[model samples]
Target: MSFDVICLIAEWAPAVGACRESRGADFYWDAPENPNGEDLPFAIERARRGFDFIEAGFYYEILRRRLPSRVRGKADSFFGSVYHELGPGCPEPPDDLADDVGIELAKHEMYYSMRPTTVRSVLEHARAVPWPEIEHAATSAVMPPRITRHDVRDIEHFRSIVWFHQDWLDEAARTGRGLIVLISQ
Candidate 1:
């Protein structure tokens, strides 16, 4: 019943740095590429090999796994259950990447971008999941104070935050999705 949680480190570098500067082993960083580089593809490729979850603001190849399968005629619908759309102006990842990879990968990207901003929001979302189904909790090593608290809390009122990392190694290991995580060095 272990579920994987992916954190978007590249998108939230400022917040992560702030959290790390303030918090302890609660967060860490491990990126092979210069997150600020101009080449997005190289960044993505390096990320693919290094982490299970990617943190790019723009949707990359790995996120395609998160999308629901679009069969020939069986009510062609996206996997809305786990997929969520971000703000209107947000930059979208390449369509080819999304199409080639699974939509779940996109879902992970969206999740990282839209993680709850408040403790209450996080608590509510975490509580929605049945405890019996969750065996592992994962998140970026660096996160906002509120999100970090939500990912680390052990109270019955909220979902238990089990493990936190900058990559998605835990998620890939659990789901078998060949996704990678991206972060800034």
Candidate 2:
């Protein structure tokens, strides 16, 4: 199974609250009945500042997940923060988030983990590490002992992931907002 990461910016406190209340898997399901489904309240889609989903950011989640927890925590702070759960009070998503049970089983249950981190904290780690250093680490990061390596160390994939987060971080720093990362497999 492949993984897709959805990076969303909580432009305001209300947005952050919405992220806390939302089901991470909800973004993928937007049937005709659920007209407003694709509109994840926490995510500031193209409506505002031409900001929408960062398609490249999905790889960042995949890269982070491949690394061992030991390497993630200290070696890579920024991406590690994205991998692990953070923030003040994050609510647990409902078990049956999707109306369609089959969809829930195939998607949600397979891998639907969401977490939020304040923009300030994200910037702190991001700012501390130089871009070149981050790139170096990502390319050389070791996978978990049990994980069979594949394209986890691909350079192009690393570049895309970095570009995605760099853009998001720039926006968060400029506007002073929080971020919510949802991983779906």
Candidate 3:
């Protein structure tokens, strides 16, 4: 499965824990129940085991996976992110992009980001990206993006992904704690 990413807090703080609105997650089952019927902790453990199966940061690997050779790099997948926490320590993209099982595992892994500092940096970079201006200009073909040449669909998708991380980072940063990344396929 291809990888989907999320940014989150490193520590589960008391305030965060106390939030009745949400557990800082985009969507999912609650603490006592993970996406699976099992408890969160057990689901997380199982996710970790599944996470250990893939590889990351290899463009050629992506190319090989495509029937028409569509290769998306780590940055491209993260919406032109500068976050480096996702490559080595983070698990690789899954083989089946449609594999919900693998995505669940990745979600658990990224939910508790392993590299909070790096993720923060990535969030900062994403926020700094000129998405708004470029989007407006592109609508008129006035000034195209200079930072990347990804197709319109990829660019748009990446922009949304970056926005998601920006929000997540902002939320976690408020608590003065590091972040965790949740990635699913």
Q: Write down the RMSD of all candidates, one decimal each.
A: 17.4, 9.5, 12.8
Clashes of 1: 20
Q: Model 3 — which ten-residue stretch has the worst lDDT?
A: 42-51
Per-residue alpha-carbon lDDT of candidate 2 for residues 26-119, written as tens digits (9 for 90 to 100): 4334412437564555454322111122222334444445445554443356554433232223222222223222233334322222223345
Superposed Cα deviation of residue 160, candidate 2 (Å): 2.6
**Candidate 2 ranges with C-alpha deviation above 4 Å:** 16-42, 46-75, 84-117, 130-150, 154-156
Tell me the lDDT of candidate 1: 0.26
- lDDT tens readout by residue for model 1, 112-156: 222112222322332343323221221212222443222322223
lDDT of 3 by residue, 1-185 (tens): 34444333434342133222353343333445447553332112222211222222222123223312122232333333423334322333221111211233334434334234544565564455444444543344322243333322333543444444566557656645544445566
Ordered from best to worst TM-score, the candidate numbers read: 2, 3, 1
Model 2's number of clashes is 0
Candidate with the greatest lDDT versus the true structure: 2
TM-scores for all predictions: 0.20, 0.46, 0.35
